[model samples]
Target: MPTALITGATAGIGAAFARRLAADGFSLVLVSRDETRLAEAAERLKQKYGVAVDVLPADLATDDGLERVEARLREGVDCLVNNAGFGHPGHFLEVPLEDEVRMLKVHCEAVLRFTLAALPGMRARGRGAVINVASVAAFFTRGTYSASKAWVVNFSESTAAEVGDPKIRIMALCPGFVRTEFHQRASMDVSGIPGFLWLQADAVVNEAMRDLALGRTVSIPDPRYKAIVAVGRLIPRGLTHRISAMIGRK
Candidate 1:
């Protein structure tokens, strides 16, 4: 079976990807900061799907952690899911500078390092895939969270083009308001978000897998989000920023 490495694999979109890939017969390497949770997630996937699961506990915010994961990626895996990320609780200006930098490390630098480490092995083997988990927030002007994710989307598209190998797929997975621990972890009050705006993690993963198979460089899971992004692009930047900020406010 092909192996897939997923960072932030203990919850949310990362966990969903773990379940989907394991069900599809991919052996898994799950990376997370929580060793206990990582072990638990690994056991659950292994038991449910009868697939091999390895847990790597690493904080992507630090150099030591990124190096550990990068070392593993260099060893080669058929797929890499760059899903580890978090959000700040308040506006960008209110948040600490260190926290902002940490977010960039996990969302930008780690993705760059992991993809670089993984691609050479994939190139040698003549096949592999990388899915960077960005957010629909990437299309808006929410804050650093959106800014970092925007970088992810751009990076994925550019890297995919530079690689220029149809067999080696690199794609961005963007989901809107996923019903996961993400909001809770970020300490965001989602009460203002409409019920219809929420999306299940499994559903997002299913569509992401489909898009990857279909050779799409970017996968926006739902038609609702696809339309939102389309319309957001058509509108004025100032209007879009105001709307986005209003919706994201507590």
Candidate 2:
């Protein structure tokens, strides 16, 4: 069975990817900050899918954590899912400097390091996939979160071009308003968001997997989001920023 490694594997999109990959017969290595949660998630996946599950507890915000994960990636896995991330509840100006820095470390630095580490192994094997989980926020100007994700999308596309290997796929998976613990954990109020805008994590993962298989360098998982991103691109950046700011006001 192919081995897959997923960061932030205890919940939300990471957990969804774990379930889907497990069902698809991938032996999994799960990484998360919470050791207990990781163990519990591994046990459940193993019981339900009969697939081998290993858990690695590491907080991606630190150097030691990044080095540890990068070391594992260099060891080789058929697939790597860079899914660890979080959101800030306050405006960019209101958020603390350290918080913003931490966001960049996890969203930008860790993704960069993990992908670099994973690719050499994939290149040698000539067959593997790396799915970097970005967000629809990338298209707008919602602060560091969007800015960092935009970097992720651009990085994934540029890396894919540079790699120029059809069998070694690198893609950015962008989802909109996912119904996960993301907002809750960030303490962001979602009353302003419409019910229709919410997306289930499993559905997002399903579309993402399909897009990866189809050789897409960027996967916007839903038709609704695809249209939204298309429209956002056509509108002026100022208007897009205002609209995005209004959507999930605290």
Candidate 3:
């Protein structure tokens, strides 16, 4: 069975990926900050899917954590999912700089380092894929969160071009608002967000897997989100920014 390493594997989209991939017969290495939660998640996956699971507890926000994960990536896995991330409840100016920096570390630096570490082994084997979990926020401006994700999209595309190997697939997954711990953890009020805007984690993962198989470098899971992103690109920047600002407000 192919091996896969996933960050933030204890919850939300990360957990969805774990379940989906395990069912598909992939040996899993689950990375998260909480050891107890990681162990619980791994145990559940093993019992449910009958697949081997490794729980790797590490805070991707720290250099030590990044190094540990990078080392594992260098050891080789058929697939890597950089899905660990969080959001701030406050607007940009109101949020602390330390929090913003931490977000960058997890969203940008860890993604960069982990992908870099994984590619060499994949290049040698000539077959592997890395899915960078970005957000539809990447297409619009929602403060540091969107900015970091936009970097992810650009970085994924640019890296794909540079790698120039069809076998070494690199893709950015841009999912819209999914019902996850994300909003709750960030304490963001979602009353203004329409019901139709919400997405299921499993559905998003299913589309992402299909898109990856089809060799799509960028996977925007939902049709609604795909259209939204398309239209977002067509609109003027000032208008889009204004809309993003409004959406970010509680």
Candidate 4:
């Protein structure tokens, strides 16, 4: 079976990827900060899917952690999911400079380093894939988080074009308001987001997998979100940012 390494594999989209890939018969290397949580999640996947699961406990924000994960990537995995990320709770001015930099470290630097580490092996092998989990916020003006994710989307697209390999794939998965620990962990209130706009994590992953298999470079899961992005693109960016700010302030 092919092997897959997923960063931030403890929960949300990363955990969902672990489950899906395991069910698809891929051996898994799960990377996350919490050793206990990684072990527990690995056990669960091993039991459920009978797929081999390895845990790599590392914080993506630091040098030591990034180096450890980078070394693993060089060893060669057929798939890499750069899904580890977090969000700040308040306005840009309210959040500390250190916190902003940490977000960049995880969302941008880690993704860039890990992708670069993994791709050479993949290119040599003539087949592999990388999925970077960005957010729909990437299209908007949501401060550092969106800016970092925007980088992810552009990087994924450019890399895919540069590689120009039918077998080696790079894609960005952008989901809108999925029901994960994402907002809870970020301590953001989601009450103002409409019920219809919310998405389920499992469904989002399913769509993503389908898109990847179809060789799509960017996968935006739901039709509602697809429409939103299309509309967001058509309108003036200032208007989109204002509307996004109003919703986010709630």
RMSD of 2: 0.7
Per-residue lDDT tens digits for candidate 2, residues 1-250, read: 9999999999999999999999999999999899999999999999999999988899999999999999888889999999999999978899999999999999999999999999999999899999999999898899999999999999999999999999999999999999888999999999878899899999999999999999999999889999999999998988987887876657
lDDT (0 to 1) per candidate: 0.94, 0.94, 0.95, 0.93
**What 10-residue stretch in candidate 4 is worst by lDDT?**
241-250
- Residues 1-250 of candidate 3 have per-residue lDDT tens digits of 8999999999999999999999999999999999999999999999999999998889999999999999999999999999999999868999999999999999999999999999999999999999999999999998999999999999999999999998899999999999999998998888899999999999999999999999899999889999999999999999998888877455
Question: Which window of ten consecutive residues has the lowest lDDT sum in model 2?
Answer: 241-250
The per-candidate count of clashes, in order, stands at: 0, 0, 0, 0
Pick by lDDT: 1 or 3, better one: 3
Residues 107-150, candidate 1, lDDT per residue (tens digit)? Answer: 99999999999999999999999999999989999888999999
Model 3 lDDT, full chain set: 0.95
For model 2, the superposed segments whose C-alpha errors exceed 4 Å read none
User: In model 3, what is the error at residue 45, expressed in angstroms?
Assistant: 0.7
Lowest-lDDT window of 10 residues in candidate 3?
Answer: 241-250
Per-model RMSD to reference: 0.7, 0.7, 0.8, 0.9
- TM, every model: 0.99, 0.99, 0.98, 0.98
List, residue by residue over 205-227, the lDDT tens digit for candidate 4.
99999999999999999999999
lDDT score, candidate 4, position 168: 94
